[model samples]
Target: MNDEGAVTGRRGTRITSGSGRGLRGAGEAAKNAWRRGTGNRMVRRTGLVATMIVVAVGGIFAGLLVAGDTQADVGPFAARFSLTPSVSGDTDVQIPPLGSLGLDSHDGPAHLTVRLDTLDQDRTFALASDANGLAAASQTAAADLRHGVILLVERSIVAGLLGSLLLSALVFRNWRRVLASLGIAAVTLTATGAAAAITFKPSSIEEPTYNGLLANAPAVIGDARRIADQFSEYRDQLQRMVNNISKVYSTFSSLPVYEASPDTIRVLHVSDLHLNPAAWAVISAVVKQYDIDVVVDTGDINDWGSQLESSFADSIGSLDVPYVYVRGNHDSAVTAAAVAAEPNAVVLDNQSVTVAGLRIAGIGDPRFTPDKEADRKGGSVPEQLNASGSQLAATIAAAGTPVDIALVHDPASAGPLNGTVPLVLAGHRHAREVSFMPPVLERPETRLMVGGSTGGAGLRGLEGEEPTPLEMSVLYLDRTPALQAYDEITVGGSGTAEVTIRRHLAAGDAPGEPASPAPSAPDVESASPDPGTQASPLTSRPGVTTSSPRGN
Candidate 1:
């Protein structure tokens, strides 16, 4: 050992290690102290580190629990689409996924599922704002919000009001500190921008052929602007086309009218206007043009003759001719009522009108029907006019008015009313223009007049045949006013129309001659009007008692 009791390395001298031992013993003592010191320091460090680690883990778990607890479990999910008003105060709004909404993909049905609550909220939103413009803005915002996830915080930030307010509030605090932070952030941004310019200038996106963002700026900008302009122009054109398309959206039916041999009787034939205003316009125009004597519309005039309000009357006002509308399967009592409301219009469910020397009859527009009222039917037209063919025939038999030209809307109605009349004016098969007379036991001389007029069909078939509106036939008469033939024209487009009328000469009695005597009308079944309200006959079944308006 050394004199001072210090540990020392072997140097052929007394060791610095003390404790009455040699250098080996002293080294051992020093080693023991070093081990003890190192062990204590390590223990303290480890304890601190372990404590921190455990606390960090516990804090994380607690945070997770809080977050989980705060979150509401909105189990199943569905999306809202649109809301449509129903006749009743409310409707069960049918949607996909059976009943209540649940987890589902967005791409579902042609329609969307909407909760009534969301709809009510939107209605209120539309009414809340005072500023005219701002009000519209709010409504638009609410609509967009309702269709998406609406988060108050996200909306506030996106709207910028929250950020502006926050900045103002921060100004109330350490102004210098805020300014310094802002300055530093600005410097950092500037430096970053400069560095980016230097580093990413000619980046991996470099192209050899195109000089746009990389090579040419003005040319690219010009091209982009031109493209945007063209896009806008086309978009405007598309919008215009859409509006124009709506004009004929409901072109349901068109009636064609022409004059017969006699100076008194004219003919009205029509089909598939569906009560469209455009169609009715053409119908009324054609009826007046040829001095139509009588109007006969083919079937489909009414879905079920129950509820009719295509505003056919407004168009009917132009007609001087007596209009007789037949019931197609679509025709209903309501259709009859609407038609009958016209001063000169009549509902011939399955009946005839004998004018002059011809016995003319008409049946309903021929179409099969499983449900009467299911086809977008509304109003009270049906209850006003309801009568069967038999009843109409009986009335005709009594009136004994000879019908020179039979008017019918549906070609199917022509079968029953054929033969009784020498000429038939009927409509149906809207797109079909050249319909020939069928083999009939009625009158061999009976010729069907097919009008190829647009009462609407604004466009022609791609194949170039658009002879829909002018399917009318103009029949000229000899001295006896005998049927000579007809002059016809093919009409196309919305501007001007043309009809190619063919002359129809029946029997061997020269061009126009007496065909046959008018037959007795058949019995017509009539219903009582609105049994609940007790509506009396409109006019006590006009001459010969055709059908009582009181008929249901």
Candidate 2:
């Protein structure tokens, strides 16, 4: 039978052969596409599983890293998420993880040279080819792990998004085409991911650290007192060392004069006067010997200033002049508050007071101490003391008050701004002594001085049983005292030395406001440095001699 364009071999059937071949070709093409799609879907699904594992692991690790980086009181500015390196090769040195270890400040003023050695290519290639390609995979894993943030932002983002789309498309495939679409999509994604894994590199960056610090509070008060005592000693020896006139020794400035005056004033001081009974005795004798005017006892007057029966407080009360004060690290803030509440002590913190014709302001260093009862393990990280300085400067600016003397307890806070103060008095670094950093010595707008301790030296009972308080100085300024002969006194000493105040006033001598009397040379009870003579700052006072950093 034949019909139109078709010819057939059977009697009852008429077929069109021209269109049959075309239909067959079209069916074959559609089947090919179906197979391809199924293969890609499977590949895409596998890649998605691998990516899910990668992301899950990365997230878990990232969380742990972030948690560990935060301090109880501070933050890791750069290490919001750090990569701590684990050792694999050499035992010679500790290789800090890249971008994790921050630039340290101990090297001085946040400056240093850095040297680095990264992986070599031959080794990298070997790592890429070994162990059934597992080593290559391992290397890629390590790189991705180390550069987790980078991978997360780059390849990971693409891989995740693409895999999700592919998986979605495969799931929606027609009734009989599910497996085919999943298989094809999966193959495409796997190939893309492997390529992305093989070649990823991180960019290097250098971060810089700067200096800043706040003034000492407890110390300035102590220095105020010390200067008074030393002035007395200087008065006693004035006649012997002078090449000049009649009143060779006459200590003038009194703590009261400084406290009562209203003018721009300058002060220099130190603190943590863990004065022992013996030391107090010497200090008392020194006070009476010089007839000092003004003095400030920056806390820790006794080893335990808070002990109900404290000789330090009694000694302080016995002293003749007006003295300012604040608590020490060892002293309880509550006790200090109580003391300040009374009329006996000033206990200045975040307070401003006029002194020696100058407006001197103070803020006690609130050292971040760990509460043992709470078993608080972490504390604030070491930040450049300047951060506090900036805050203080802001306070000063807001109050619109100018200061001449600054006091701090520890040397660690004497960052560059610390130098900006006319005189910064501190006591903790019994070693750094009196360093003179000029306002443009090595830098501009900066000058510093490390006042040695007043409680003499040796390990005191605080940590171990021995004695190390401080041995310090007194300052003198003439003219602000109410009377020409107003005198103040401090008494205490180590039996070996007794402080004696000897004054010979000239007719016109106005001993009223002066701390050190006019033109008198001085003598010292102990010419030899304290036992930690090796650690004494006076021995290393900037102009006195030269010493290596480690030497002191």
Candidate 3:
């Protein structure tokens, strides 16, 4: 019986083991089937994610290419704004007839362009004619630009998402994948936009590269820091510009135009800009109106003569005419180098050059007093200036070519050049003056013409009881390169919007004749006429004032 039981138990154990094997085999089969199902699902999801990424990238680029542009009115300008794929990360402004200005606005594979398409003449006229029109237009334009940018961004994102969804739907014919694509696109766009915002640069506006005619317009924008800090002052400048434009338009339309003889040489004399941006607009307008052949800047073009300040000299390239420059006390070696770098600039430092058919000589100031510090050389400023003038005169004599014009920053430097050069042009006093130095030792009489602050003494003009006048002169010269007549132009600065142009004829003496000794210093009468009235021609009276401050 025990033998039988053992056999039965072994059989039972064998049966149980067989049943357990069967169960294990079934479990393995189910696990394999489950693995196969899970792998297929994972493959599908991986493909969908990859597809979504591809669709998102492709759709964004397509959208940007197709619908990444918008148009809006920017003040009197109709401007088009666009985004393009680029590594330059630049914001470019294109103004037709002028040129382009480029700024490093961000680090990106994207670039922004603002192209000024057309000017609304009617709008311009309205703005120019109305005293408050420019301010109103500026505000409106700012709002319009903001709206346009928002619209552009919105359209770009919507178009991109729609494109992605359409692509996904076409590829998968499934709502889930299409919906998934939208989420992916939104995430991608959000990441890109956040990156761009993080990299955006606002100070880039201060270091713009001006191309074409707009090259000369840099000074008009002035310092970007000032623009940001003193927006009201900037608006006031715009107002002054509009008022000047209106006055110019009205004056030219009604006045009897003086047709200069074809052989006459027209020279525009400017000085003491002191980094005033408004001066560039005035200069450009005057250059165009007078058909100026050459532009002569006496000195003090910048206030600080800093390397950064040297950028103001960039406008010299855009003047479209010969620009003869002399260094003022405020201009340093760095400033001179910057002015020399311009394509059309001629820097005269104890040297002579011929420009616009006239031989010109110039000498830089003997001192640099931007900080109002006395000269470190420990000598009289005037004496040092006279020595510098003597060196210029010697250089001119050595050159053996007759110089028609002599440029100096200070009148003291101009003193020794008297009777040596026929005309000595200078600034630095911040007031206009004209003096006739009678011929001495058989030399011809020298006419000393000092220009006032062309930039209205820049920011310093604001400190006075009254805003200093913006002054410039247009000299009409004969073929002999002799001064025949000149127009002294004064534009009321800052708070005023009046422009006065007085014509003065250089008579009573031939190009080489001796003239009567004029007053040592004559009083300069500030001319403030009705907005658009042209002053009658006046006799050549000396407008020099001895009581004026020495440095600009």
Candidate 4:
């Protein structure tokens, strides 16, 4: 019995030892699996943070690079200028290929022609410059343009980055999600940039590309400071070119404002002067030739509405006829002040004025920056203009002053008053258009006449591929104070001096007789001709019978 008990105790001890060994092996396996899982999680987290950092940094850099490149690609103004350091003391400035501004590397301003959409021919401004002057002016203009382009590029890049960040904040709820998304975006952008670089590798690497007329030109190593100094001096000189243009226009004048008869009254309509001093000459000539008793100017007389531009008002004051004015989207209180100071000027903002037995009411645009809103795009009528139209209509209705003519700068603003008045005159479109109000709108005979740019887009017109034309209208009224007939004049450059004159009968049903045509040989009609072409003789008299449509 004692031997059997010892054997059973030994067996029990062996069983207990084997169970303890098995438990130890299972515990080691569990610890190894946990370590592997934890290690993978840590690796993934580290990689994600690194990716986010790279994406954020690379995206910003790529954005800036693209902005700079785009800015550098577009040259400012119509002309491209190149300045090179010559062995001689004078710098060699070349204006490659001629442009609308009539900029030539060899020919000076004496031979420069200004092609406008307003004139019948390419008009010449007595710029009166030599080789030295041209070189100096080109240098200055190039510098100013370069500075402007740099500021534009920097602003664009900053705006883009800020917009992206704002958009991300709005889209992402959590900080981690934002970071992750930004990392992904950065990776995508980097890949795109790499592909672009491979496709269009730059050929030149000697110098950095710059914006403006001085593009692709080599840097002047030794005389960089001198070149910079020249820019400052030439900037003033370049401004003189504008002044010179103004002076040339100032020299032209008409005979005098007069009426053909007591039963008939003639008026000159102009708009969108935009600070082109040359407009004075056109105005003077038109007034004299048409025997205009009054002149109606629909706003935008000045471009920036600054006090400095007020001097152009001197031309308006010089017009012998009654100058009736209204404010436009481009005009400001400063412009109003300037126009008010004119001896013959009458500024009518939400007010009425009498000229030649006709009551004229006017309204100013509501928004100073008409181009800021989305409605201003695609040549669609601006919302502010619609609002202004409502305001004008309300003003006219409240006064109940029998406004014969409603004057506003924007045609959109004039819509509300279209059927309420015999004539609604506006100017913002820079193109002449006549639209007759439908009978359903209340008055079937009411007409809206939109004038082209009278200032011919002023200095602003010369900046782009196409310049606005010089345009104005001559209206004839009989004893009834109703529009009898009108002439639409468009003057501009098209390989020669070109003038397009369209005449139309009154759309209104007021009592009146067809007035006689514009006086024979109006001096202003044939003022500026092309270099070699003969000035067109003003032979046809306006107010003649025509079957032309009343509106476009």
Candidate 5:
């Protein structure tokens, strides 16, 4: 009986072991099946999500293209504004027959465009005829543009939401996915709009890249530095300028078009504007009137070279020609950077650039004198300037290319550059002076021409007994890149309204020869119109050459 019981126990143990093995095998199989099913479900969900995202993004872009544009009357002009998906953000203003103005307005993946559709001739005529109409119309136009922009935004949002829903419904045939797509569209657009708004630069308007006939428009519209009291006068001046432009355009169309010599390059040299808004008007006027190929500014463009003062350099982009600039004692790196940012500007600091068929080299001043409390480094001012000038001369020598002009802010710095370049321009003395250095050794002769204050010494002019005159020079260069002649333009400051132009011939003396002494008094051709018939800034009398020295 005991043997039989032991055997029974052994059998029971074996049976239990067998059942445990079966249960373990079944559990492993079930786990494997569950993992496969879970993976499949996850993959399906991921695919659906991706499809919904793609559809939403595509629909939003389509909607924006179809419904994001709006047309409205901006004063006397009918204009259309549009928003579209883009890789980068920009604002484009398009005017028919004229060219377009482009601005880097933001850093989002969207672009905005403003197009002038048509003009209301009757409204234009009526507003132009009134003395105060331009100011009033400008205010109305700003309001209308704001309203139109708001409307466009609202419509774009609604359209994008609707478009996402439609696409989601068609693709997934599910209400949940459609709602999800709408949410995603909303989030995307909100984020994009926020980025654009945060990065938008209203000041960019002052630095637009002008193209077409509109390239010359800034001269007519003026800059944005006028005082509130001058608004009326500014408006009046704008009106008169517009009328003058129209007459000129009509005259151009009626008469034979006057074309400048193809082989001749005209350069307008201006310096020491000191942030004077009037200087921009004068520069633009001279550029347009003289058909200038390039503009060379010697320095002192700003008083302090502060970031706030940098915006004044925006006008350099509107000059419709290449603007080559160097730094002065008053200008800092901040000012140089601002000048370099303009689309048409070429900033030279111990560097060289070829512009408008002329190779030019320049160097910035070694001293920063604006901050009186700042520590002085390197050496004394004159010594540092001399070193900088020597460095530039070395750089030009290494280039193995002939530089047509060399620019410096201080005459002291210019001494080391003698015989290095044919023409060296400087502008620190605040007086127009010219001298020719005879060739030494194998070096060629060099002409040093100094320009006066283009802004009439800026606000400092008020402190002087006599107002400083606004001065600039126009240089004519032949295809050989040699100086042919130059005109000295002097405008009376402190409300003098008098303009004088003195022309000088560079062909009077042979190369390497000493320049003759300047006449006791150079002949000046003055233009002073009556108050009732004030000549436009664009108008100037023809320049008459003086019998002064060859290098005058």
Candidate 6:
């Protein structure tokens, strides 16, 4: 009986142990499966995040394409760019920045004209001079723009949908989620648009009118002439943009190339207008083409700083960029007042202003011509320049802040400022010249730059036996706030009003030194060897290259 009981117990123990081993193996297998499944889900989630990022970035690119094709209605103008299939079915498409402008006439309805000059074709038509006329033009332009944007959208969307479908089928093995993913992207984009709408503000630029100025004019034609004089800058820009579209495209390669540096600043230096209306057109073109940050006028804005010449203020006021003006010997109190009145103009004489993170200080010329008389009749130009320079230098010192640039009209005036500032820019000489002053006993080298007559020396340029060519300077600075180089541009002298660019390097700056290293005062010199100095047809030069009239 005892033997039988022991054998039975052993058999029961073996059965229980086998059952426990099987349960343990099953649990371990289940745990391994769970881990594999979790890893797969995590990978899917990561892919979704990546897709979201790609969609967002792609959406931004699409938005830019739409914006580039669309043009918002400014008060008097409507612009739109279009690319459509030609009737000939040729793929060689030349889509220019084409647009139209409206001009309102007295008592007559406003007229809308087509901008066909973009195709090298000149066609002009008239429209009514009324709000309805402008509205009609705006609607037309907007329709074309919308059509262009829609075409782009259709192409992008169709391609994206097809790609998404294929990717879904191949990756997830589920086609329905393709639509679901698209819906999610669309919702995200919609939310972004809603946020933008909530924060958008209407532009404050209003249509300019001259009702008061015309009211007091002597005759309708005379007033019209006066109005044209004041509004020529805007007209020139618009007309040139339309008619010269081909030229712009051809010369596109000549345009300034900008690098991605927040510290670098581009300056357009123009001076010695001497009441040349065409100067505005040239300066405006350079400003827009080069993406200039600020315009520095070292004085001599008018031939004689008289009240009659004050009308030139209209041109100065019309500039869309910041205008920093200093009084030249030819300027008077009335001239200064005219500049000060312009909302866009800043009178920098005996004052300083910070622009694009750089401190700029300017001093007015010593001589002021209230009437149409010259102030340098008896006193020497040099003496007057010295006096003004001394006073300005003293003022800057008292301020106890170092100025990056000092602006004056006379190059001689720049001498006193040597070692006090990094760069000194002047323009009274009516010829372009650059000089590098070596460091003196305790001061650093100062770079002096002079701009030629932006107006080609005004009427005097045409009167003299010879005329000066229209010239201007574009200054380039690096992240070190150190002068890198400059381009001296000359436009139209004897033949076609072609543009010529000459590049010059800073005198002492290494050929290609890194701007991040410790900076020292840079030396300056004309990029080219001195084409032996000659007397400028319009003004006496203090040893600088001369040019001839630019008749554009």
* Better candidate number, 2 or 3, judged by TM-score: 3
Task: Tell me the lDDT of model 2 at 517.
Answer: 33
lDDT of 5 by residue, 1-552 (tens): 444323335555433455667899999999999999999999999998888889898888878877778888888888998888888888888876455899988879888888887879998899978877877986787688788778778888888877787777888888888888888899888998899999988899768998754564454334434433344443333333333321221011111122236678999999999876777876787798878999999999987666657889989999879999999987889999999999999999999999988999999888776544342778777788889889999999999999999999998888788889989999988888887765668888889888999987765644444556678999888988888777787665332234555656676545545443222243322332233553333432233321111110
- TM-scores of all candidate predictions against the true structure: 0.39, 0.36, 0.51, 0.49, 0.51, 0.47
| Top-lDDT structure, candidate number | 5
lDDT at 133 for candidate 4? 45
Q: Poorest 10 consecutive residues of model 2 by lDDT?
A: 538-547
lDDT of 2 by residue, 1-552 (tens): 356788765575656787788899999999999999999999998886665444433433343333322111011111122222122211111122211222332211111122122344565566444433442453464344345344333443344344434444444544323334334444444543343344322221122221111112223233334444443333223212111111112323321222313231212243555543444444444345334444555444433323332424555566555556655544555446545643435666756576546455455545522122222323342342444445555555677666655555554444534434544455555432444343445432332435444554322322222223234445443344112121211112322222223221222232222233323224324342333533311110011111111110
- Per-residue CA lDDT of model 3 for 352-459, tens digit only, reads 888889998898898876433446684788679889989999998888889999999998887778788889999999988777765688778898888899988876
Per-model clash counts, in order, read 82, 81, 2, 14, 0, 15
Q: What are the lDDT figures for the candidates, one per model?
A: 0.40, 0.39, 0.74, 0.57, 0.75, 0.58
Clash pairs (backbone) in predicted model 5: none
Give the per-residue lDDT of model 4 (tens digit) for 1-552: 444223335545433555667899999999999999999999988976665555454545444444422222112233222221112111122232211221212211111111111211111121123435444545665565555444543443453354345445555456775656565654544453344335432232223333222331223123444544443333333233222221221111221223335577788899998876556766776676556889999889876555546778888767788899998776778779988998998998788877878898998876554224433553544666787778778888898777888898877776677567888888888877776665443454667778889877665454444445678988878777777677776555422234445555564323223222233222222233244543222422533211111110
Model 6 alpha-carbon drift over 4 Å, by segment: 1-263, 369-380, 507-552
| TM-score between candidate 4 and the true structure | 0.49
Q: What tens-digit string does per-residue lDDT give for candidate 1 at 351-425?
A: 665443334566564333424334234333332223232344355556676555555554444544444456666
Better of 2 and 5 by lDDT: 5
Find the number of clashing residue pairs for candidate 4.
14
| lDDT accuracy of residue 127 in candidate 1 | 42
Model 1 vs. true fold: TM: 0.39
